[model samples]
Target: MGIEREIKLALPPEQADAADRFFSGIAGTPGRDVPLVNIYFDTPALALAGQKVALRLRKTPDGWLQTLKAAGSVQGGLHSRHEWETSVPGEALDFVALEHACDDAAALAALRAAASELGERFRTAFVRRLWQFEFDGARIEAAIDRGEVTAQVSGQTRREAISEIELELLRGEEPALHALTVRLSAAVAGLTPEDINKAQRGYRLCAQ
Candidate 1:
């Protein structure tokens, strides 16, 4: 039960450009441009009603990943959290090196560019803070992450009571994040290949 965690403040949807400046000073991971998709899942209106809570599934060439991000209350103030994430190649869970720097600049640009290509469906529709989690299991490898997601609207809205559980694995000093990623790619689904990164891939830059 090894899980890694990171948290960041979120810029409003219209102010997403802040992420570009925020990451510019930090990220340095390497990769070619690719296609990406962000999908948000909603609970029954009856469950959350006038509140904000959603499950976001992001699909890219690497594969598909899921996040539990919602506008709600918790131990902290009113902050959103990413409960779980799934990787296809399974090797992505341990790849935290790029994540920290990606939280910086170059990474922000990639996400912004990807989001732009995604168009209105995913544009500055909504914004929430970001929280990331990684988990590895002896029997299986898995993870849970939290990021911004969109609100929901339905033709015939129904309501239900619901709460979700998320999991994540962090590759610490010994195993290394990259090694953990490989392990997680096993039990999860809807993840792609490119999401994987080396343990220190972004270290040099992120440390700055």
Candidate 2:
């Protein structure tokens, strides 16, 4: 499951100007900030339990949108890289609005809380980071320009490093996987995930 969540905010007319100013230089470019909004959905009224395992979506000023995602330690259970972890793996708390950008914008500050308690209950978890690599003719890869994230999982296998480009599309986020897979396979013609057999973000796996 993904940890990042999106939310929309409806700030007061005065707050709008400040919010925009705050996020003016957030993410990559100016006025394009990607601050992780700090909104929490608490669980167990008696106990803080943990950061709500969800995000809060809301609307912002100038018709702009915002999102806040959950963040925390997700331990136990099966890590995708392995299938032998105990139980308990969850997200922290947050609100990330960038996910649903073009959706209806008339509504303001709508929220949805999860049915379970907060706190992480897993052994291992996945996080986000960026890395740079040069693809040699030894392998191949592809990318789909969809809103999906383009995080490439890479590792060193055997004699060469292998990299497999990956993206997360919604359960039914337009363009079926089958159809998209074909296009991706074609685009990644000769790549056999050999670029990154045991490497990711900036970590190395296996006995390298």
Candidate 3:
């Protein structure tokens, strides 16, 4: 499992274009703009959520990827979580690899039991523009996502708009990422720290 350290920021939908323009000239290798559809799963009783675990299947340009993430602490806009992901041909979860990804025996046991009852709860579809940069001795992967999250209910779909900026630390210290955010916030109006993640937002939409 790899630890994920990043900051998530919610952006005004109208400001996305401006942010895109600003990031384009930054020092980094420009990455492809791609679409991503992610389906989040949970048991009927929310067993995994009760234990602070989340499972998802993401459809990207490369292929489907199954990811299992453990709930981690978030302070301000910084988040630190343990994440395990692997490529899969289909949407189904691979229990063996997921179990192997668990850090402890107890977590593995819970995952094993919950796997059988997992079902899709909500989904997020977005177009992501990306770049990888070396800033202040840190390698940060920056992304701008614009799309919507949908939740199905009784044969209908409910949609919520999504526009955010993410800066993930690929290498080096967390402080560098924080420093960059400060700089960007000054240059970009309406840019604020966001503590909620996509999963949490989707869950709230599903509940509504």
Candidate 4:
């Protein structure tokens, strides 16, 4: 288990090109675009969500990974959460591995109880443009994600656009994360701090 700290920002659709250019200029190279497909799971009653836990299987260029994120806190667009992630053999979820990785007793029990009933709730598909750099004695990964969140409910489909910047602290003082956001915010217009995460967005789509 690890504490995931990051700041999320909502980017207007129109500013995507400008954001790309800004990052490219700083990195001295174009950001790498990675297409990612993530399928979130939960029980019929959304028990996990009620517990503020989120589970998902993500397909990345490297391979499939299963992640379980427990509720943390979001303050001023900065999110701090407990995350457990592990690579799986294939598309299916490996609950055993997840249980082994989990250190929190309550979260582990919840995972065990929900394993049998878990099913796909919603999905997010997007291309993430990634850049890694150093700032103020800190290492950070900046991702510009563009795509949509989709869900099927009552024979109807719900969709929402995904255009956001995620600044994840790889290593360094937490304050540096905020400093970088301030720098980016000034250069990029229409950048608003976002407190809602993709999983939350997925759950909301399911409700509509």
Highest TM-score: give the candidate number. 4
Ten contiguous residues with the weakest lDDT in model 4: 104-113
Report, for all candidates in order, the number of backbone clashes.
31, 56, 0, 0
The sequence of per-residue lDDT tens digits that candidate 1 reaches over residues 58-140 is 56666766443333332211122333344534322222422332333432333333332222112111112222333232221
Residue lDDT tens for model 3, 1-208: 6899999888988887777766776753455699999999998777887888888999998889988888798988788998888888887878877776667665576678887888998899999999888889999889998898998877889888889999999999988998999888877889888898888888887778
> Positional deviation of 77 in candidate 2, in angstroms?
20
TM-score of each: 0.29, 0.21, 0.94, 0.98
Give per-residue CA lDDT, model 2, range 87-189, as digits (tens).
1122322323222432322111222333355322111112212211122211111121111111112332322222223322223322332343344334333
lDDT of 3 at 64: 92
Report every candidate's CA lDDT: 0.29, 0.25, 0.85, 0.93
Candidate that would win on lDDT: 4
Model 2: which ten-residue window has the lowest total lDDT?
77-86
Compared with the true structure, model 4 gives a TM-score of 0.98
Model 1 residue 17 CA deviation (Å) reads: 6.5
Candidate 4 stretches with Cα past 4 Å from truth are none
